[model samples]
Target chain A: MAPVGFRSVEVALQAGGPRRTKASCHTLMEPGMFIYTETPEIQKLRKNIVELVLTDHPLDCLTCEVNGNCELQDTAARVGIRKVRYPDGENHLDREKDLSHPYPHFRPVEMHPVLPLCAGLR
Target chain B: MGTPLRVVVDEMGGGFREPVKALHIGGPLGGLVPMSKIDDLSIDFESFASNGFLLGHASILSVPERFPLVKYLEHLFAFTAHESCGKCFPCRIGSVRGKELLQKAQSENYQIDRELWNDLLETLEKGSLCALGGGIPLPVKNAMQYFSEELKPYFSRG
Candidate 1:
């Protein structure tokens, strides 16, 4: 999949013959074009981006329900984010969980034992 | 575009009688030009860029000398946080974090960690999907650059 914040293009042509323009990860490479995938600048930017997201996120990975099965955890590991540099500030972690939905189907499967009977009835 | 900024403020806008500390040229996300540098700048994109500022929208909001620049910076952050579309994380969360930092500094005299501050700005600049997030750092950076003395108390000791 194309990286987030990057445009996905199947085919791009330089119809105007290459005037000055900004390039991103999806920009089509031309002959003799050189691309730097993991430069110091790129690494720093990637790390910083992940750190920013983690700054506001709760750091309760060890005790969280999805400890072993989380995409953010996987991405953080891949990016090598050993620590989040941002200081503790306003965050949504402490907000009361919204359990207001009336649908029991939205709850965990174990909590709704009659779900199987309903499915079989259907 | 070559017209002097002073002309824009004084001649066209009918100059203020009271002392003005800085001019927030352009809209809310625009860079702040301290009173000291107002005369030297011209109403152009390159001029603002060279001076570590931005001429976005070219609208001016004059800040009086009595007003605290930190408060102005806080307002900018608050505006961004409220206006963000919530599609992307960097802008959605970063703006709120920025606002919180400023609020703490204002209310509790908190000393912000400079490294963390820089990291937050960098993330917003590089990771955001659009200008709303990317361009915010320009004005904040301008204030930090031009009005460092005013903002000194808010930053932690190195």
Candidate 2:
């Protein structure tokens, strides 16, 4: 029988092409294309990215932080999104800084536990 | 039963053996699944979930809109309405309210306070029929709970 599976991370990454998945699900992706095999050098890069994103600056950069724990940095350190280019300005949202809440009523960022998706209003 | 709901379950013959049948089995999202493959005439739930090709909830949701946000409730609920059974007032009404509240959330409309959206939720939850009316609140409620920062501007003290 043909092996059937849930949509693989690799297949989704390929089908989405880039511009589609990049906007929302950046974290859920697997970065096997970035690093084919796990090596010592690759592991070190993964570690550094995790410490910076998850440990050192968990609440800081990246949009994924808002929905509680990030899947990207988690997987990055685990699988390796550490394929760094010196010229990595291909970052999607450059003008993200300008957008901000205007008034006195805005809430400051607060940390919280990640909640599971609702189990269908039951 | 008028017509049996087709359910497909795949079995791994390596030791674990369980046989299940479905008078009316459905996919994870309450959508009707096509039961194309049946080995011995009985539909299997475990097989469908385990080995069956995963259906695309996120992909289907993500298709109409560029992004899922406070803004896309209309698109989202459009999907729901077609999917809705139209049996109860709550589902029929709740889905309509979902579009409105989502729009309100997106535009920062009204005061974004308890009175406006809360009343809508209360009505839908208590009054709707079947699962559709009841289930309509999940996405809208999620946006309110999770995306409050985006909604801060709309809240009103008065």
Candidate 3:
């Protein structure tokens, strides 16, 4: 549950409380509990959330590396976010990528082969 | 906890020497109550929540008349952005976007789209993983409700 609003399972277990916990996609439906996943309100929330994320994210999906394979792109499409409603403002899309470590170097170069052999022996 | 707000401010803390506009009770994620309502409110969770406010942490911060409410709202958003643990998307991205929106409104006299602003608030309130992102909208909404006149310039005409 990535965006579960409930603090814990105990909180969710409480029923008819003054402040009822907002259920996430992964919240299990129990007996006597009614969960509406596809209500109009939920649909609107889904779209709005996608739009909010898009407001800060770069909109250069067409030119981006993970254009088709991106989860965000898929969610945006699913939610039918036609436009990002927020006005133009500051964003981190244009920030320079930190390229200090171009390639990762492994330590103990000679031990690499021996380690694999040791693992195989085990 | 049932102590009157006036008792807390005037009696215990020694009343403000200067004119104050509002009281930001409960900390950064708390409710912002205008002076007019201060007399009716009490230092209790139910009292605050009944009026669309929060009694979080029970801390009080006085807002002076000279301090712009819009700037205060911007600071709340900025604080949210700074403190977010980046464990979730809505808090991490939404906080930064909200701060940016307020910055543009303050600097360029921009009028943010009303529908979009509500949408952002709803997302933060409902989609965040924890209270850090969820509770921030409480004070911002309070400002929109109680200090509407001051925030009028920043909202679109529609």
Candidate 4:
């Protein structure tokens, strides 16, 4: 189960007391913990992130190799980036794609300690 | 400082020349000025601050007439992104985004919103953890201010 309550740092430490092994205790285990507060600045930062990613991206959403399984697409959606800030002509689409690698690709979630999510690059 | 100091300009072709339009000082992120403003400007701290330029430890980048100022700014951001330490949130992400925006603007022919661009620049300038992130926008803004007419062809109303 996920932690749903909070105590003072002092209280929490005391509660864990002598019985606590490193594995026995943790902090801010909730998925929403450390959530980014959406200020105007944060919103701009997010928009800029989308703009940057799309610069090299072909934006071939319908025909991409990853198609519905792309992390870049998901990030764009989550950030509410409805439109790219820059023009599409500037993307360096001349670079060749390398598809010969045999290894399976997955984006490892670096979110936190407990639950990790993986999006495969197939 | 302005009387004795000499400005250097470099064309992308790896040759250095005197400023045809503006002289870039203080590395890639430093302020730029038109050649007409050269004698009026000084190289001292106070003068640099007042004129929106940097002393840049005698480092000067001479951009010729045809050199794309916007693309140069974009590359500066790219370099900053590559060198960022990743310890701070703003610098790590902001540089990457700034690089992208510049690329897109160049690619799209500058059809982007002016307000949005300014806001993002403001955030990077204020929030970056180091000079790498914060200072990269200086030259960009300076270019826009002094070279707006030259850059207009790269933009559209929509």
Candidate 5:
């Protein structure tokens, strides 16, 4: 139940620690803590972020290459996202896909599993 | 008190009880049971939840026959939205969305995506982080289950 979103809220431990933290979620977490309460507020805030991001996102979940593997989709599912209320608000229709980015790309791995170990080290 | 009296009866347990079309026990998170089951209920958590009702604060709300369950649901959703902590996604956004959805049903000649709304409710119920988000669906489901005939008029195709 460690706050899900915040990674940057850092607590300097006397020992080793995680490299970087997502602040919103990390602020509520401690270095040595393995389990934290995922408060209702955190769930709501995270869900709101996803909803806001999805406003401009394309509605092509079915045809998209990422499809089931997409992080957004996964987050949405975790938050039980069923319907996007902002269908007419904004869309990604104008953004063209660019493949120019190189490999070894930045990926955000969920810190839940490793967080305890990192905190334990601290 | 053990005798099941109809809602129309004015006397109960030596107290004058007002006639109500429906009774809402356990506040907004609670279910609206038909008047027939009012006397049959026990003030216990297991019994209340087993009946799809909340064993919440034990607040009782009575609605007259003329009031619409859909309208009550809209107000309940709005109330929950205002009371939300502005945290977790499902409760924060879903409360507002739920209120809006119920409001949309109020307009004349509207087409509602019933399945979509149901799915939205399911998400909010399962995904929300707290009771505020998880409990909002109770009354709506109660209305759907017990009073669909009354709510049907609000959902006609545009």
Candidate 6:
């Protein structure tokens, strides 16, 4: 049975605004090769990368502490990024902390819980 | 448009164990919330930094806070990092300094949180670049503003 007054999330979202959304940090890396331009090349690469990382690939780690509790998967699905340039075993990253402070020193950078991805990596 | 956007939890590069666990240490605001904790929240610039945190596909997952000080400042950090005008000094130098101060506050110097942070924050607040740098102090400052007594342990105890 439906809730007392529940038509659909889409309806609720529409009431508010755009319910269709996603968590996309697109760099808009348009071949900075020039001064301005999203060059078809860069866009393609971006789309490819997006697809690869998102597919069946794990959004949160296998046993991540934030598992179902994670926002990454939700955002990714919203963005519809099911493909990338490569696969899970492809791109290398800033897996370790680049720098540290005297008190709360950190090693692995990509580790989200330690800090936000913005402070750690691209 | 409505409320804050969907939360963004990053299990960076297999960093966490699958079927992740949740832990909220920020007292009530941060205990350990699961996905079920969040429904569909509509977030726009209010929750976005526009610069630092929202670079490409990277996003921040927010835990609801009874007191918005820490959470909001947490949002500002990345924004300052991203929107930094690099125009004058404070925004540029101050934002960097703000990061340092945050590091200090979160440090082990439990004996000198006040004296240390007060000075550190004063500098960043006064000399930062855009509001980005200048604003970073709000979270910690506001925390101290309202919770200064709670934070006195770092100073008076010393």
Q: TM-score: which candidate is best?
A: 3
Looking at model 2, residue B104 earns an lDDT score of: 55
Candidate 2 vs 4: which has more TM-score: 4
Candidate 1 regions exceeding 4 Å error are: A1-34, A94-122
Candidate 3, residue A53: lDDT: 58
Per-residue CA lDDT of model 3 for B24-81, tens digit only, reads 9889998888999988888888898898788889888999999998888889999999
TM-score of chain B of 2: 0.47
Fnat for model 6? Answer: 0.00
- Those runs of model 6 whose alpha carbons end farther than 4 Å from true positions after fitting are A1-122, B1-75, B104-113, B149-158
Tell me the RMSD of model 3 versus the true structure: 8.5
TM-score of only chain B in every candidate structure: 0.94, 0.47, 0.96, 0.81, 0.83, 0.40
Best-fitting candidate, scored by lDDT = 3
Query: Candidate 3: misplaced stretches above 4 Å?
Result: A1-32, A65-69, A94-122
| Cα lDDT tens digits for candidate 6, B59-96 | 33333434333334444554575676543333443344
Q: DockQ score of candidate 2?
A: 0.01
lDDT of 2 at A108: 17
| Model 2 spans with C-alpha error above 4 angstroms | A1-122, B1-68, B104-109, B155-158
N/CA/C clash count, model 3 = 0
Higher-TM-score candidate of 4 and 5: 5
What residue pairs clash in candidate 3, if any at all? none
Kindly report which residue stretches of model 4 are placed more than 4 angstroms away from their true locations once superposed: A1-122, B1-19, B108-110, B156-158
| Consecutive 10-residue window with the lowest summed lDDT within model 1 chain A | A104-113
Residue B24 in model 1: lDDT: 90
DockQ of all candidate complexes:
0.28, 0.01, 0.27, 0.06, 0.08, 0.01
Worst 10 residues of 4 chain B by lDDT: B4-13
Q: By DockQ, who's the top model here?
A: 1
Q: What i-RMS does every model get? A: 9.0, 20.9, 9.6, 11.0, 9.2, 19.3
- Listed per candidate, the RMSD to the true structure in angstroms reads 8.0, 20.6, 8.5, 11.3, 11.2, 22.2
